[model samples]
Target: MERFAALYEALDATTSTLEKVRAMEAYFRSAPPEDAAWGLYFLTGRKLRRLVGGGALRTWAAALTGLPAWLVEESHTSVGDVAETVALLLDTAGIGGTAEATTSLTTWARDRLPRLGQLDETERQALMVSWWRELPTRQVFLLNKLVTGSLRVGVSATLVARALAGVAGLPVAVVTHRLMGDWTPSETLLPTLIAPGETAAEVARPYPFYLASPIDGDPAQGVIGALDAFVAEWKWDGIRAQIVRRRGETFVWSRGEELMTDRFPELLVAATALPDGTVLDGEILAWQGDRPMPFAVLQTRIGRKKVSARELTAAPISFLAYDLLERDGVDWRERPLHERQAELARLVEAVPSPRIARSEPAVAGLRVDEHGVDRVRVELPLPPVAALAADAVGRLAPLE
Candidate 1:
């Protein structure tokens, strides 16, 4: 795909480090590798560009400059630290805000990697680390994560899959299902999949199938009331995650593609506690009793290499599922939201089983009829606050 080669050209173009990061992000999203080796390249490039533009990579630079590599590794290998490292790197560089920095890095990385695709994992890691050494130790760690492909910014797989499908001129549904198996697909597939009319970013739908672009101001302020198309979910202020129980094994991945079940033992236990052979859409929330704990409380539970027993006990996480993506070899994404919700509910409560969420009825319809069968669709309503069944207000919270 020209996208891979295009990104490589962008990295070497060196308009700015922000451009490098942006290019790198696109590369990682599509490159298709995530092991420690790949992680090295991704993280290394990430930190260098981030540090250069001024972010968390700076603190690492400040503390670890010319310091031994061992100490730096300890601080930055973990996911949580890696993210803060980005912000810190920018800060160190005297860079401000993500917009300017990310854009600069995106373009720079585009110019940095000339033969990026041709390099093997070890060579890629070495090249990234050496290049990062030009920065500082903290930045090194950040770059380590990047070179290794561990720059996790909560980008969703479905988003990349959509992008890939768009490039391929195939239905997004088909692309998404192709990735529904044990292995995650690479970001490089995107340009390969790009249909002639679409852009790479267009491939990813924040909320796919059913679409809702962000709006300005509070959505409750008459925004919902004006929409002829749209639906609203509380947008649960928690980690966006997917629960896939396939081949009798359950995997819980944050939207960024990090397999995070171990960090919240309760979640893994809770998820495995449900039915087998299914995929679910939900938020992993910090809970005490039935109500959700504040987003602050949940924050401690995310992005960890290991969760202590103490942490697990104090901040328990729960999967508040909303829809089912798969069941028994079926791809349910094309199914209406209502039916998907029902199937998701079935995963938790069919016959006798544990339930992660209750089925809340949502309107589903045919967006376009084809081949004599009606396609199920998600209906987004006008907003202010989301209402149910068109006119109901107080009892409803989404579908406005």
Candidate 2:
């Protein structure tokens, strides 16, 4: 726990990317694999759901520190953070004690945190107070934040992946693929996660999504003179999702790295129509007949563990596949956009389902005059009416 706290402080104190990566790499090399796994879990921005409410935590801290409840509340407000406020108050109250007995991060997380849920409020409070007395100030702040599920550091998942890759002597992409999907921190899984090769077990993982930069200036200046090098599609106002079909199983992941397989059963059923080892990058939108419903309609299904039959019929979701990331266990991200777009069109056409369809393509509008100067124009189709507006939307790129 103390080592993890020091790593957190080192990461927080620096803005240099190289320094952060070095600190993370050093910690990964020295810490036990079990302890490092928990550290990786937290450092990657994954947090346990709030097991205890903020009010209860504040009250408990106030009682332990012998401070008035109102004073604690005021300190929290002044600090703009509840965890830091409680730590500061406790530290100033002179509740120091020797760190004679030590606990590992793995033991505290795997064995201790879960037991708190089974205990009564009195028992929980006593255990928390004991922890406060024994742990250092840094660990105390971290513990408070962890209990409320509000811990946040400046480090990003990308940096963490890079550090792990450095420590394991593997490519960053391999490390990234291993980190995807659901897996618990254990002695067995840790070795497999850092290994150089893929695990034999069936796992559905998503490829890293390629993102486009926002247009800042004139749209024409953003594109090269070539008129047949790019493909354009509607920027749908829906959840950006990746549908993965691998090893005779289908998985759906949102842009936020959430595995939403059970949330949309209809999509999973539709995925069975696709071939095994096919991966798609697309948008999930609510549709009725040939038209798309508002994003608000899809919001009702988000975060749901199970969707009722009536709700399924009412919303009626479909996937608007835009690009093909993988086909038959082979990655196609290095291929040109036009080639991928053609393959995507073919795949969508073969599916033949109302629940899955291809996104509308942007056709190039061009003309040639007597002067022999080639002129190019692009057309974008609007929603609901689906009419082409020649002068409204700016061109992203010319289609091949």
Candidate 3:
């Protein structure tokens, strides 16, 4: 816990990318695998969800420090962070406990943290106060931030991947892909990540998603050069997901890297139509007949452990696939967009489920010149970010 707090401080204190990478590499190299697993989990932007809320933290901090509720509120307002405010107040009280400087990051994250979420309010307060008194103010701040799900170190995923790649002597792409999909903190995670060749993770692991960047608006308005060189599609307002059908099993991974196979069971049924070694990158939208439902309707299905029949009927879901990332066990991410899209169209046509459909390029206003070259100076609604085969959106190379 103390070591993690120090690492957090080191990362937070840095504006230099090189410094942050060095700090992370040092921590990964020295920390125990179990501890490193948890560190990687947090550093990769995963969090302990629904553990504790700000209101409860504020109330508990006020009670623990013997400070008035109003003072706690004022301090929180001034500090602009609940975790730091609570930690500062608790530190001034000079509380003490036996666990100070002894508990490991693994022990805190794997053993204590989850238990904290399950306790009643009284038990939670008691346990948190004991921990508060034991840990130094900095660690207490980290604990509070973890509990509240507000721990932000301002490091990009790319930087973290670079650091891990440096530590393991692996390519950044390999490290990033290994980090994608659903994973939990464990002793084997670090070894598996740094492992030389293919391992069990490859059986179900998803490719690192080709993400989009924000652009001002319409690329056709001289923002980007020629339109015929690009194929434009609607940026669907839905969850960006990778559906992997490998080894006769289906895995649905959100862009956030959550394995939500169980969240949308309809997709699972639809996935049966897909062949093994097939992976599709697309959007999952709540659908009603031919059109999509309000995104708000889709929100109802997220994070659900089980979908009741009534709920499934009320908000049916569909995967509007746009890219074929893999087919027949071959990685197609290196192929041209048109080539992948051509294959994707064929696969969508072959699939019998309405739950899966293709997001086709908008061709309403396309024109061809007298020389028979396609003149595509169409208006786009937004500054488009495209997922080039080998690159992320907006960081595009010309279509081959």
Candidate 4:
């Protein structure tokens, strides 16, 4: 972290971008014998100038600057910590709130650990997870964007983790996994995650699984045909979730993975029929006749842990089981898309809809949970995150 921080500090010291780049290049290339490291190999190659002169000049430079930042921060994350944190932030913040959320997160991250330390791998990871929970919606959004440091301004989660990995003598890949959480981090409990002894968190409610930028909002930004190659989806506007039913206990997690069972008891009851030791991705839609009930219909019953019979009848929740990530103790992440689909189909058949969504007494049969009333519970809806091919959504589309 000190090395990366010093790099950033050097960037601050320079007056010109070219000089800053050159100075960094020189420092990395001519690092002292004791300081010389393999990761700095980028400096020894033609990459820096190539990155600067690249057609997309800004992107290359941004990527370079952000790597260090991500490395520094990510050193503090781990498996159990990453998934829970990601789940929470996705449910709470989404992407629109990125910048504001980042500020709170940086502040909390500062408090969580000393800026400089001779810490080991585990200590660093614990630190990152500790303060992850305190972040607000905006901070969570910002944290999610840390992957590529896709945007230029804030520190990237990947870079933070990378730095941590480098210092702690852990594999960079491992660190990245911990930092790039499967669930939303900032929206949930990233603050507490980095703290100490916290485990099995639920994501934040009200946030979606992923935040998509509005392409139509700026059609002229070369978006006219950009979506053509993409596998389009409704981008369902509703609460994002992950449903875990294990050993007869069903847990409803928001995208942030916060235990949301009490907030929407109807869904928990419906989850009772699921096979023991199963994880399914689904939407708790405002249900009416097997279709998505209006979001307005769901508003009547959200956030209240206890619901009256009238409330249950008025807004019945349904779990739209989309994909199954785990079944019968098998980790199905590495399976091909078609294979996963088959597995999901089998699981669905085994569990069946009847078991997934129950009816309120006297309220006909199963209906999808309406939006706003309850939330959606996704499995490890992301293959990259879940290590599967396709998530609960449609088939994976190629990025342009």
lDDT of 2 by residue, 1-400 (tens): 7778889889989999999999999998888889888888888888877767778878988888888999889888899988888778888987645444357888888887787788888888888888888887878888888888898978987898899899889888778767876667776665677777677643587866544444334435533333343344566777888899998899998887779989988888888888888989888998888878888999988868899988898888989987788888887766766677778888888886767788866443444335443343444444311111122222222222
Tell me the deviation in Å of residue 316 in model 2: 2.4
Question: What C-alpha root-mean-square deviation, in Å, does candidate 1 show against the real structure?
Answer: 14.1
Superposed on all Cα atoms, the candidates' RMSDs to the truth, in angstroms, are 14.1, 5.7, 5.1, 18.7
Scored by lDDT, model 4 comes in at 0.42
Badly placed stretches (over 4 Å) of model 3 are: 50-71, 93-100, 118-123, 216-223, 262-275, 285-318, 352-355, 365-400
- Local accuracy by lDDT, each model: 0.48, 0.76, 0.82, 0.42
| Better structure of 1 and 4 per TM-score | 1
Q: Over the stretch 171-290, how does candidate 3's per-residue lDDT look in tens digits?
A: 887888888877889999999998887778887888887655534555445544444566756567789998999999999999888889998888898898899999999999998886
TM-score of 3: 0.80
How many clashes show up per model?
Answer: 93, 0, 2, 80
What TM-score, to 2 decimals, does candidate 4 have? 0.42
Worst 10 residues of 2 by lDDT: 384-393
Best by lDDT: 3
TM-score for model 2?
0.82
How many collisions between residues are there in candidate 2? 0
* lDDT, residue 144, candidate 2: 83
lDDT string for model 1 (321-389, tens) is 766766674556556555565556666664232325652433333232443321235434311222222
* Candidate achieving the largest TM-score: 2
Model 2 misplacement above 4 A: 53-62, 67-74, 98-101, 210-230, 262-266, 299-312, 364-400
Error of 4 at 249 (Å): 3.0
Order the candidates by TM-score, highest first — what do you get? 2, 3, 1, 4
> Where in model 4 is the C-alpha error above 4 Å?
1-153, 161-235, 352-400
